[model samples]
Target: MKNQEVADLLREIAEYLEITDVPFKPRAYQRAALVIETLAEPIEDIWKAGKLEDIPSVGEGIAKKIAEYLEKGKSAYLKKLKKELPIDADALLSVGGLGPKKVKILYKTLNIKNIEDLKKAAEQKKIRNIEGFGEKTENTILEGITFLQKTENRISLGFALPLAESLKDQLLASKRVHTAEIAGSLRRSKETIGDIDLLAASDNPKRAVEAFLTIAAPKALLGKGEKKCSVILTSGMQVDLRIVKREEFGAALQYFTGSKSHNIALRNKAIKKGYKLNEYGLFKRNKRIAGGTEDSIYKKLGMAFIPPEMRENLGEIQLAEKGSIPPLVKLKDIKGDFHTHTIYSDGRASIEEMIKKAESLGYSFIGISDHFGHLRIANAMDEQRIKKQWKEINAVQKKHPKIKIVKGAEVNINKDGSLDIPPAVLRSLDYAIISVHTNFKMGKQEMTKRICDAMEHENILVLGHPTGGMIGERKPYEVDFDEVVLAAKQHNIALEINSQSKRMDLASPLAKAAIEQGCRVSINTDAHYPDSLEFMRFGVGIARRAWAGKADIINAKELKQKS
Candidate 1:
């Protein structure tokens, strides 16, 4: 929550600066915002350690603003911006095609202050009549509104997971919780989550519940009970906390950390063995048999313990019964990350900082796959710049002897289905990732063929964000997964499970399907900054849910040996 609070303020500052015609300052705030949003550690902790300036792109000024906000409950600069602009920059900026300039035009010309106002303007054809906005742009705004509306009530996993974990830590810190675990879809690592569920076993349930309410400082209380409580957080996210005895903790967790169907199947299996399964315990005719642990219950029921992410009742139960559950890819199993960006592109951090961070993580290698070719919006590098970067990388590699820094580029696949980089240039690099940067409106056949045609290039190592789905925002471009997966297999290109919170592309099911078809997939953070390197957890989680073992992940082994 603290991280997001800071990130939002940074983003708002960026939007306001851009709206006011300030140059360079807007991108600075934007870069800082990206870093904070993707950080694995809590922002408050960094501030408490007096190391805010150490964060990527956070200069002394930005650090002061962050520290000021952390100390006080608000940002004075943001407050001043709001007073001057009086515009809902956050809401307006959320619309896909609307930038700060467009937002300013809408606000000044049409009195459109927020998403609702913009929607009304678009619907009434008022925006199209305005200069610069034609029918196409206005129509796109309406579509963005519709897309934004669909994501109401649910929050992205990127935001939800950290919030849940932080709350759980607070509970433990209160010295009231004996054991606590997050449950529900949040535990399952779903791309987007509705409500957060946390279960705990406490010696003093009343005291534990009281401490939780105080730490959470909920916006509103929904209900109250002896050991259970529900409240709305400041972010308007619903969180539920339940306390149980230590013996029943595992049982309660197993019951509540379910996908309904998985639980139902478990009960049915227990019934066949003349046992009862419930939140309390698995019981015989008169005595308790298993309840002390989740594994105990599964073991008693004659099945292997299923991982929480795989408890979706999608053939997992059958596999568990057969003791054939595959060992899913773990975060620790990853040896290197291939799809990272640095300052040579639009990334916030420099190449040296990225390498140092990777080294700190004990990574054996890190790929500097900055944006390349004609994607000008990304500040892509040309051939000369690529050559320059390689020299810098070569120099940096000498200093970091333990880690192999590979020079790579995230090349764009043009409309005509050819890579933007020349063949000669592509042959000189460690690797290249082909992605669709424009023309998302292409039909499925055209889009699939375009990507597949690009896949034929021998220089390509991976298909970056195969589906290009942005969670709760832009839908994936039209493309048949089977054909794309087939092309990837034929071309020996690994599909990337991009781990950006907003773009957990290669959705778990599709990733699983690709693996089932004997195609290897790479789990990458697609990190734009050093801190975002932590987002690798999201990709690993998705891969786990996809039932991918370490062997199924490209980065989990020696890179050259995989292909």
Candidate 2:
């Protein structure tokens, strides 16, 4: 397990202990464990690197524990906690408002252990009569239990992407496999993926299935088959694998890797051409036929090849037929990021730290567009604070003359859709990224008008994360994006492809429409730390899917200018 994961488990145990009235000592252990977990490097890495003392969280006591784990493979304290604490650490979190201390009472006194036992106790009214468990608490626990059971296990696209890439390597190495590629939500770069789907071409589907089954690591084999198999990883992520003959590769790939809407559109298009489409292969009426490649399939339909990002039935087919498909943007074409946060805001890294990290990643310039005063909780700055930040960023720039530092702000667009900062102040900066932070409940017309008002601000060069939704938590504001994009183009404001893993906002189709309407894009990492700058790939990926090109992005030529 990763060091952070181990720490998170320890924290959960501590929370449970707090609720259960477990001895005070357990809390200390949990605290130390959390500290160890949040360190930039893990205790194991520190020990391996011979820099154990250098880690901020590794005090002498924790350092000794690290050494023990390194030498003994397990901690004595961890074992003891598990043996004594009968309560399921994670289940304690299910009881709303009743934390670790209360959890111990339920476990030790009421004999409640897991969610099942807790639910039984609640159903029987055994929990309500308990000393600390009130009627309200009982209801909350039951609701939480139901929510947990109904909740589907999902993984972020960022985490699943790497895993899919690793598995693709393994599949490609298999003797029977001729071609393998990651597909489905993963290929489309969805913000959150349901499961990973991999498609492979081979002569021996049996051998391919066997090879997939034989490979092992922290995975629960969901099932096995000649054509398809599913497995749940230790991280609770599901992955599916499908294999087919080389002749059917293209058709199978297109069919299996799909958004249902996209597939239906493609199928309908094929029907118009007198061809039938399915997972196995494409057929003309009842006769079996073949399209050797994706290009051939598109050519057969009398259309230009469509990139996977444009696969969604959002005028892509029509655009391709009219020879007006937007050119896809690439990672290499991005010259700079217009919206990144640093220690000046809620960011974990300092200005110099973020600059060096961006430089290492081959970027020519990076903007420090931290939150403005409207988001004080995020350490948003006022004018004076921003002036101080400018001094710091300027000093760093002098030392690294090759990389430019653009001073900017992620200024809040208020409830009525007005820029939080005045135009005079906004114009003083090199650039501005206006974003909505509140009043997301507005009607579509109001929301569109609100954003349009912000776009009217001449100094606002980009709209940061146009959709203010966080995956699984909030729905995006109701806005007429077509009108918003039109307004943006009129004002020459670029739309942002936010690179934060949780937000990958301005999704492909919306971005595609924006580009089609002549509104340029500015792909950015709304980075809060140096390491997060790397997440620019997610934004770039969304832009590529939207068919954004070098000419469509503001910073695409800035790096070349520096060179």
Candidate 3:
């Protein structure tokens, strides 16, 4: 899954092009980046198959660049762009509202080349005096810089997961490694991670370490040993790989993939059962009893195997002991995703492309839930546009008969407990997902009432990203979620487990609480593009971590037509 690595390079190139005022190529590179990141298979594998141009939005020109990246792990065009700009694009982009254009202006006008310069300019009121930047924008830049400072060490799971999996896959392919899996917080599917931990088993530890170094192509080596190695990835993520014997593999993986508290609980349980537990194996009077497999160790402990995500010492042990750990929802349980966007609104892809991607995912149905009404900034559809989209959907359905293309709209919950989309227009929609797009500073009572009011409307299937939390960007808005959950249960509105990486709102704990209150949830990618539909597994991960079952998820069943 060099997919992420290549996508990042393409995005970097796009940023450079945008800064240099290169027309059209920037958008092409941006689109290609999205497609690559969302690819189902590894980009390296795709290049190996000699079908680079077969990728959507990848023309002959982009294909050559991708091939270059695949072969040399560097793009000549990207290198040229970097030589031209010589600026840290990612640092400036991290500011809330700054884009490449603004970055260019800052660099050209004020010689603000990095976050430090930008921060100083904002603090000294120099940015506000600039032509394009205002006082408010200056204040926002300061706030964003503060946020970045607080979270500079934390890496979003969205980036870490794919990059870690790519490294894991590479290790396995080397043949020196018998098995390899990413461990640590990444394995638990936390929204943000610090670093990556990989555990593996191999007959030849020295060969495995050498293979990892070759595959990583690290920017710098932190440590290297026969059985243990550490390096810094190009993405600035630190990866530590450890190799062990085949017999100790499971225990080693479990040991490394720990929440710390879970291992403590397990060790206590092992002691009570007259067993000594460590990375080697579960031992009974110094005689190794179980270690070959994770399931074997769990079975020896008189408990069911706990999922890595649920190993947070969050009441999982009791269920494992009862041998009735609820059957957590999986990605395979998803029948369809009801929340998606297209060119009708702010989405990157068109309606047909979205439908085709859904079909490729073998979805029974896919909802085109574009922004509607007060979301004018997103180019949201009005009555006429909604009807036109319905017609277009009707026509597109003819070409794709295997999956049902349900027409839906995402509406904003007004502060006065009303919906932006008129009820008359909503009736024509197969479903409506309501969200908090504005007025996020409302008090808890007001926010809860607003969300509950909208859920009372018919065909309102989901409360989209109920918490409105964006990882490292925005905190969840103040809302009485308990009250909201009660209302959802009363009205049968499903809580959404939005899996947008940065916005996995109605986070695991909230989803768990909703499920415990007998309110169903719908795990959706909230995909803005066909490639991002790949985020469904991350949503499912949240559900599983919350101990949700297929029955607890609404889209696990067939979708019925609205009208």
Candidate 4:
């Protein structure tokens, strides 16, 4: 973990303290912690080097606290916090739609401090009776807790990808194992994964299975056996492993790498061929046969091997019938990003650092579009601040001749379905990206009008994440795509494909619809930090799935002249 991660944890501790009514000191510590996290230097190194005061947020008071923590291997403040607040305060907050206030109420009013306590309170109907808490909220909290317990708590695709790779490495290292690879939704590159699947092959299945179970576990083991093993990591993700013979490896890999619908279709294909297929192997005439290679099975079914990414059953089979599938888009094809934020708003990185990071990745241009007025929590700037920012941007552009910095704003779509900034103010920007940030209650027609009103403005260049939904958090306001896309086409406004792992907003179908409507696409990493630019993979994956080409995406070379 990095110092920033620790800093974030400290902030959470502060929030919990505020809710628990711990004191003002904890909030100060939390603020200082966030400041330290945003600093480029390593906190541990600074403490060891006796230079705590050099950190921007570490003043005399924080310096003393750091000294105590470094010397004693703990902080007195944190110790007090842990004693006063429950250790699982953050876990309780993870319950969908539950805030710190509610968690605090459960702890203080009902003596509920952990999941077990909360569940017990809910079961006894104690939570619903609390002041400010009602039956509906209680049921929602209970459902959230159950959902969190049942599913692997979500992690970024970047975080999960390495675990899958590492497990494959460990399994393949065994002498008996002939092949090992990751399968399941992960192989298909879904934006979110439920559980990771591992498929392995060996000449002696028993030895391979035994070896797999005996492998050292970095995370807590949930189950261990011959054919399969399941484990839950410290981060709360579950992984499953399956072993098969070398000949059956390909079929097993494909079977395990299914989006259920895709697998069902494949099974139907096999059925039509008078054969049976499954994760274990393929069979013919009620007898095991051709269970080894994926290519062989596909050949038997009169089809070529399909890429894992194209297995979403989104016309992939029909395209395969024509012996054609769109070429996969790669990270290299991305030439710029549009919807990035900086310290001007609620971003961890600065404009210089953000532009440098993108330039380092060989991007020719980057748009610095921080939040516009109305997102007070994010310190969103009004016209004056944005105008001042343009001066700084122009200077940076002059200094870094290799890259172009497009001055932009993520203008809020206010409650009345209007851009937070006036039209005259928006026109001053080199580019303007209209986004839905609040007032999501409006139904399809109203929501469509709300976004279309902004896109209709000639100066607005892009629509950022048209539907403001966060997976598992909020559902997007329903909208008329015909109106939204058509308005974008008429006004020559590009639609954004936000590359955030959590919000691959322009899903393939929507992006495809945008393309058909003659609306250009921008695959942007709404990157708040330098590290977030790496999320471009998910965006590119979705674009390829949507049958988009270089000409279709505004950040690709074909669209460079316009940029």
* Index of the highest-lDDT prediction: 1
User: TM-score for all predictions?
Assistant: 0.95, 0.74, 0.90, 0.78
Clashes of each: 0, 12, 0, 3
lDDT of 4 by residue, 1-563 (tens): 13543464566656667677766766576657755644444566678788887665457976786667545545677677778775577677767657778887788788887888888888889988998988988887887777677544665454456557766777787776888988987777666677788888877767876676665332578776666677764335677877777777888988888878888988898898889998766788777676677767766777767778778787777776676766656679888888888888877677888888888788888889999887887789987888888888888888888888888888887756677887787778888888887776677887888887777665787899887756545555689987888888888888888877557788777887888777888888788777577667778877776677787888886334754
lDDT of 1 by residue, 1-563 (tens): 58987887888899899999989999899888888998878899999999999887899999999898877767899989889899899878888778888999988998888888888889999988888989999888888888889877767777888899999989998999988999998888877889999999988999999999999988799998989999997667899999999888778889999989999999999999999899988899868888889999999989999999899999999999999998988989998999999889988788999999898887899999998898989999999999999999999999998899988999999887899998998999999999998988788999989999999987788899998777766778989889999999998899999988888888888998999999989989888878788888888888988989999998998756657
Residue 215 in candidate 3, Cα distance off native in Å: 2.3
Off by over 4 Å in 2: 1-154, 173-176, 203-207, 214-219, 264-277, 282-292, 321-324, 382-384, 414-425, 438-458, 478-487, 559-563
Which structure is stronger by TM-score: 2 or 3?
3
lDDT of every model, 2 decimals: 0.89, 0.75, 0.87, 0.75
Candidate 4 regions exceeding 4 Å error are: 1-14, 21-83, 91-159, 169-179, 202-219, 271-300, 512-519, 558-563
- Candidate 1: minimum summed lDDT over ten consecutive residues — where? 467-476
Error of 1 at 453 (Å): 1.1
Model 3 lDDT per residue over 1-563, tens place: 57777887888888888888989998899888877777778888889999999988899999999899788867888778777887898778877769888999999989888888888888889988888789988987887788788877787677678888888987898999999888998898877789999999999999999999999988899999999999997767899999999998888888889989999999999999989999988899989898878888999999999999899998999889999887888888888998999888878888999999988888999999999986777788889888899999999999999898888899988888788988788887878998989887688888888888888888888999999877777667888999999999998888999988778777788888889999989998989888789899888888888888988888887776321
Model 1 / residue 442 / CA error / Å: 1.6
For candidate 3, the lDDT comes to: 0.87
Give a tens-digit lDDT track for model 2, residues 201-310: 88888888878776534358878887888887545667788888788788877776677788898889889888888776678877667655666677777788778766
lDDT of 1: 0.89
Q: What C-alpha lDDT, on a 0 to 100 scale, does residue 421 get in candidate 1?
A: 93
Candidate 2 CA-lDDT value: 0.75
TM-score of 3: 0.90
